[model samples]
Target: MGDVNRATTAAARAPKQDRSRATRQRLLEAAVACLAEHGWAGSTVAVVAERAGVSRGAAQHHFPTREDLFTAAVEHVAEERSTALRELFPQGAAGDRRAVVEEIVTLFTGPVFRAALALWVAASNEEQLRGRVTELEARVGRETHRTAVQLLDADESRPGVRETVQGLLDMARGLGLANLLSDDTARRARVVAQWAALIDAALGAPEDA
Candidate 1:
C-alpha cells in the first residue's frame, strides 16, 4: 500500500512540473517579443504576462522582478540560439566557411539580437539593470566566441587567430547594427564573402588539419 501511494504521488506531481516549465517558457518568449516590439519603456511585467497568456502573479512567481524576467528571457534566447547554430551544422563547420559565417551573422541580425539591443540600451540608462545586463552580455559574448571558434575549427594558440575570430564577431555585430536601419542584404552578402576569404587566409589550416 505504501509503495503504491508513493508511485501515485510521483505521477500526480509530473504533470504539475511539466505545466510549470511550460508556463515559464511562455513567459520568457513573450518577454523577448515584448522587448523587441515595445522597447524597455513599454515592456512591463503586466504586459509580458498578457502576451504570455498568464497572469501577472504567475509571471512574478517565475520571475519576481521585471529586471529578472527580461534578463532571464534574453539569456534563455541566447542559449537557444547557440543550440540552433550547433543543430544547423551538426557535422561541424569543416568546409564551406561562407555558410558558417553567414549563419553566425544571421544570428546577430535576428529578432533575439534586436531584443537584446533593447535591453542593452535600457541597461545603459537604468542603474538597477546595469550590473545584470553587463554580466549577461559578458557570458553571452564568451559563449558566442567559443561557438565561433568551434565552428571555424580555429586554433587560438596561433598568432592573431583569436583576434581574427573576435574581429569576425565584431564585424558581424556592426553589420547587424547597420541592418537595423535598412535592408542591407546586397551589401551584407558582399561583406560576408569578403570576410570568408579573409578568414581562410588568416586562419590558415583548420584545427583538424
Candidate 2:
C-alpha cells in the first residue's frame, strides 16, 4: 500500500550531496550487520563508525549519540526491507495466496527480522532505544498488515479479518524466535502450514500453491 522508495534510508539522513548520502548508507548497513551479529552492546557508534570505515567524528556528526545512530539504523533497515517486500509481493495474483503467505513467513524468519528482533529484546530495558523501537514497530506493523492484506486480496470487511492478517506477522515472528536457539524445523514447518491454511481460508483460497 506504501511506496518503499518514497522515504528511503538515504533520504532519512537529509544528505545534500552524494558523498554524504554514501556515508550514511555505509553506516546504516554496517549497523544492521553488527546488530544482527553482535547485539546492542557491541553496536556502539565508535564500533559502527570503524566498521563503516568512517571516522568516529564523522559518525558523531551524522548521529550525535549512540542512541541516535542505532535508532536511525533501525529505521534505515526497516525501510530497506519494506522496499524489498514490496518487490516480492508485487501487484497481482500470479499464484495461489499460499505462495504469498510462505514468502511473508520466510521474510520474518530471515536476517533482517533477526536484527530487528535483537533490537527489540534490548529495547525492553534500554529507555532511549525503547522509545524509538516502540514507535517504529507500530508504524511497521501497520504497513506490513496492510501490504499483506493487499497481496492476499483478502476481504478486510469481514469481521476479525484484519487482525487475522496481522496474526501472520505475529505467528511468523514467534516462529523466528523459536528457530534462533534450536532447529525446530519440523515444528516450524507445521506451524507455517497451519497458518497458511487459516490465511487461505480467510481469503477464500484453496490450500494449494
Candidate 3:
C-alpha cells in the first residue's frame, strides 16, 4: 500500500485550473486599469498582482516576466475592444455621417485607446516593449482604418480616398491624446464636424466626382 501510494501522481484539479485562468484574467484587467489610469511605470507586476488580489508569486507563475505580462495584457485589451467594436458597429450599420464620425472618435477616446497610448509612450523609452507595441499598433491601426472606411461607405479606389480615411483615424487619435492634457472637447467637435462634412461631400457624391 505504501509503495502504490508513493507511485500515484496528484490528479489535475479542474476547479483549480479555472480559478487560475480567472486569476490571470484579473491580473490582465488590473494591468489595463493601471496603464490607463497611472501610466506604465505604475503598472508593475506587483501592482497588478495586488490589484487582482493575487500574490506576486502567482503573477510570476502565470507571466514569468514583466514583458510577458504586459504583452498578454495588451493583447487581451485589443481582443476585448475589437469584439466590442464589432458588436457596436455591425457590418450593415447605417447611420448619419456625423454620428458615425462621432462614434469613431468615441472609440479612440475610450479606455482601450488610452491604454494603447500609454504603451506607446512607454515603449518609446523601453526597448523591451517596442516590438510588441509595434506589432499590436500596426494591427489595430489597420483594422480601425478599415472599419472607419467601411462605415463611411466610401470608395477606397478613388484618388485620395484612403488618405482621407487615414487622416480621420489620425485626427481621432490626436484628439484623444490632446484630451488627456486639455479639454479638447470643443476643438474636437469643430474638427470632427468639418471632417464629417467633407466626407459627406466626397463619399456621398458620385465616385466619378
Candidate 4:
C-alpha cells in the first residue's frame, strides 16, 4: 500500500514537471519574439506575458524582472544559433560547402540577428540591458572563436585568430542589418558570399579550395 501510494505520487508529479518545462519554454520563446519584434525597450513583462499566453503574475513567477527575461531570451537565441551551426556543419565530405555557408548567413540575417540587434540598440539606454547584452555577446564571441579556431587550425589565444573570428562576426552582423533595411537579395547574397569567402580564406579554406 505504501509502495502504491509512492508510485501514484510520482506519476502525479511527472505531469507537473512536464508542464513546468513547457511553460518555461513558452516564456523563453515568447520573450525572444517580443524582443525581436518590439526591441528590448518595448518588451515589458506585461507584453511578454501577453505574448506567452500567460498571466502577468505567472510570467513574473518565472522571470522576476524584464532584465531577467531579456537575458534568458538572449541566451536562448545564442544557444539555438550555435546548435543550428553545429548540425549544419557536420564533419568530413565537404560537399555543398558554399551552399552550407549561404544557409549560415541566412540564419544570421533572420530572427536571431534581429533579436540581437534589438537588444544592442536597447542596451544603449538601459544599464541592465547593456550588461545583459555584454554577457550574451561575450558568450557568443567565445562560441565563434571556438568554431573559428577549429576551422582555421589556430589557437584561440592567438591574436590573429581572435581578430579573424571577430571580423567574421561583425561582417555577419552587417549582412543581417543590410538584409533588414534593403530589398536587394541578389546584392546581399553577393556581398555575403564575398565576406564569407574572405573568412574561409582566413580559415585556410581558400576561395577555390
By TM-score, who's the top model here? 1
What tens-digit string does per-residue lDDT give for candidate 4 at 1-209? 99999999999999999988888788888888887887766889898888888889988888998888878877887788777676766652143434545665676787767787888888888776787788878988788556544443444454465686667667667778888866657987787678766655554542234
Q: Which pairs of residues collide in candidate 4?
A: none
Worst-scoring 10-residue span by lDDT in model 1: 89-98
The TM-score of candidate 1 is 0.97
So what's the TM-score on candidate 3? Answer: 0.83
Model 4 local distance difference test score: 0.72
Q: Which portions of model 3 miss their true places by more than 4 Å?
A: 1-17, 205-209
lDDT of 1 by residue, 24-67 (tens): 99999999999988899999999999999999999999999999
Structural similarity to truth (TM-score) of each candidate:
0.97, 0.84, 0.83, 0.84
> What's the CA error at residue 129 for candidate 1, in Å?
0.5
Q: Which has the higher TM-score value, candidate number 1 or candidate number 4?
A: 1
**Backbone clashes under 3 angstroms, per model:** 0, 0, 0, 0
Better of 3 and 4 by TM-score: 4
10 residues in a row with least lDDT, candidate 3: 5-14
Which regions of candidate 2 are displaced past 4 Å?
1-16, 184-186, 205-209
Sort all candidates by TM-score, best to worst.
1, 2, 4, 3
lDDT of each: 0.93, 0.79, 0.80, 0.72
